[model samples]
Target: MKPIFPAIRLRDKGNWLAGRDGIVMAFFIHRDHSEVGPAIWRSIQAYLRAIPPGSLNWYTSADGDMVPLDDEGWEHNRHVVIERIGGGSRTVELRESPSEAGSYQVEYYGRRLDSPFHDAPATTLSFTFPTEYLVEHGAVRLRSLALELARELPLNFGYASFALVSTQGSWASADWDITEALLARYAGLDAPRAMRLSSDLGTRALAPAWLTFLGQPLLGQLGGIDALRDALPFPEVSLLPMDGDRVLVTLDEWPDPIDTRTKPIPPQYRALAQRMEPFLFQYEGEALLPYQQDMNRWIRRFL
Candidate 1:
């Protein structure tokens, strides 16, 4: 079957990390204890070569020399640093899998940035298909050509919260939408204050605004170290402070969306869709782009 990525143009949100302006890196990882070896490198080169000449490009040298798919330039190392030129200014590399652990990691940028912009590095592409195309297709497609490189491998995808993500000086100055449930629970504190409680604390209703984690067996290391598990809060029915202002409410995916009145994020079985103020990005499907460009726009649009 044909793949959906290259055939479909996915709008990238890019990363919203503020202040430190640097290149957004794209990482492709796999499990099953596969190591980056000569065979794999050759496979990658061949794969790239098969595509239309200028559609994608990878480099093995700083001068931007292409890794030859032919017998001429086939050399492998425990870890290989390949700079991907066409798809944004991202550095792609693969390391030897550890002895006992099958660990895979992916970092995605948010919305698609039109390349060759005024940015210093002139990020060309949005790291659209950074990793080997097959690896990016992942387990969903049974006949993914790139899968031949690393068979029997599973992946976990997510990206970091951009450094520019510090929002709201305090609950007083902060404007969070308050949910009816939260109004009932944190009755004493007003809506603004309740918003702080949900996010700062590990409330089940709370989800991270910076990074998103997807793929089977969501790992804490991906989205965040302290993200709430798939389990719902003790009481199935609890009011969450979605907006810290006027008792507005939204709930994350959990026991059921029945009473919440909001649909859960499909398939993933988790929803962090509530627009947290100061949130500049939406970490969806493992891509960490700027889901929302303007803070105020994001709040008004989602809320």
Candidate 2:
């Protein structure tokens, strides 16, 4: 069988980075932790080790303690070169460190295993081992390794808001093709169309909506919705506009009619709202305020 990994597609990007080619991902750890623990490093090392032996290689600084800056002037927190490819291809770089506020940060450049013979493929490593592993019968990467480590570590891992990124060294970038057909299969919801509203506003609104629903990974949230979708007669996910305290759940148009504060959520939207309550509450808490603010700005800019 082909290597079964979960490949993430692009959701949105800023004007500058959208044009570039790359993969972006982020992990948000609990605020209380001052530094990453041993387990995270061990997990990282193990994940790196799982790659095909000769295909995977990394670098260590000469001083061996402090990191060495590369051509781009980025300093790897661990002072370790995760991997160094030999060819003239674009150099891949990874920078990781904790912020003054305390959350861990990471940015990778030109880091992805490209197809031995494909470019601009819709999917890359969807959390799976390389394709060679399936037929070669040797050591291979596994999704379970990452998933297990994730369960043990205290961090949130998922798609990063990619910009004009160097995800694929030369040309292979994984971007979401958000056609209604793809949306129906991936999100179990009808894709929003440029109907009923002025083209510009509708175009803006729909992009952010799709990112929230399909770009970010919602392992736990999806688990709950999967059960709900199986048990109840509701779509897996939906988007609404929050007007003051009022949230409009169904949108057949742009600039939906604003309701007065006295209005209650209609019966049809109640189930979808209830199903989405946990994720809403979890994301709306105080801890993520700054992140939420930045995300809101991105949406507004993209929309």
Candidate 3:
């Protein structure tokens, strides 16, 4: 069956990795997880669930021991490599190690199983893989479909921000940043647009609104909104006034008529909303601080 959406299977040997490890196995489609549309999410979910259990292997280091793993456990511990193609015919490999600087390598793959891209093999892809594995695997590559899947999922094991970022050091704000970047790249807007959409502020009102908005009744007294807003990607505050606070934003103007906003609410969104609705009462009318519970709720909502 010509799969609905493309997906890549990630496996590890020697070090355990997977969803639980803050590594995403692959980016599949779901209503709430992506703006990519339901059809795409269904295709991706099918591709992943249909992965014939045990088709992939996982490795992990436990107590100075490298052990093989089963599907469930492996999926929880392995780090997934999100593939991306950047410049024409080029693939960029990203792996990071806190012990050292990240290894950024770009190369071309013509005809090989490890080679994932198929567009004349001349396109550039940017992707994230665990340095712990890459150091052992020694320079891995992916295909075009794999890259696209990675970009779509845009998160590694629910840990690292998958798009335009190399590490998960900022896992706290990964989701928001990823969403903003995706919107900016596809919709043509920067941080300002993200803020406006989430905060309901206008261009001229952005400044004063920002001051008061940041001090929202809920988020102000706790001094949490500033941190949250700072975590987002926005145009420089200094540049906002000169530009009339005209932040860049993208609207789909493609002539191809691909309706990204196709209707029919998704189950994932419903499920997520349900999951988050309960949390609103957890704090009992207090400002929604950025606690793990708050983060979890937002993550549920965003995904």
Q: Pick the candidate with the highest lDDT.
A: 2
Candidate 2 accuracy as TM-score: 0.31
lDDT (C-alpha) at residue 109 in model 1: 17
Question: Of 1 and 3, which scores higher on TM-score?
Answer: 1
| Least accurate 10 contiguous residues by lDDT in model 2 | 194-203
Give the per-residue lDDT digits (tens) of candidate 2, residues 192-302. 111111111200122222112211223244343345344335342333322221121221111111122323423323453344443331223567666355433333221
- Give Cα-based local distance difference scores for all models: 0.24, 0.27, 0.24
Residue runs of model 3 more than 4 Å from their true location after superposition = 1-95, 99-265, 268-285, 290-297, 300-303
| Candidate 1 TM-score, C-alpha based | 0.26
TM match of model 3 to true structure: 0.21
Candidate 1, which segments miss by more than 4 Å at Cα?
1-60, 71-90, 93-139, 142-270, 275-303
Please provide, for model 3 over 1-303, each residue's C-alpha lDDT reduced to its tens digit, 9 standing for 90 to 100: 110111111222322221111112222111121122332333333333423344223232333233444554333332221122222111111222322212221111112212233311111112233323322332112222233343333111111121122222222233544433343332111112111111111111111111111112222222343333343333322111111111211111110111124433223323323322322212223555566344333333322
Question: Where is model 1 poorest over a 10-residue stretch in terms of lDDT?
Answer: 98-107
For candidate 2, the per-residue lDDT at 35 reads 31
Q: Global CA lDDT of candidate 3, please?
A: 0.24
Candidate 1 backbone overlaps, count: 31
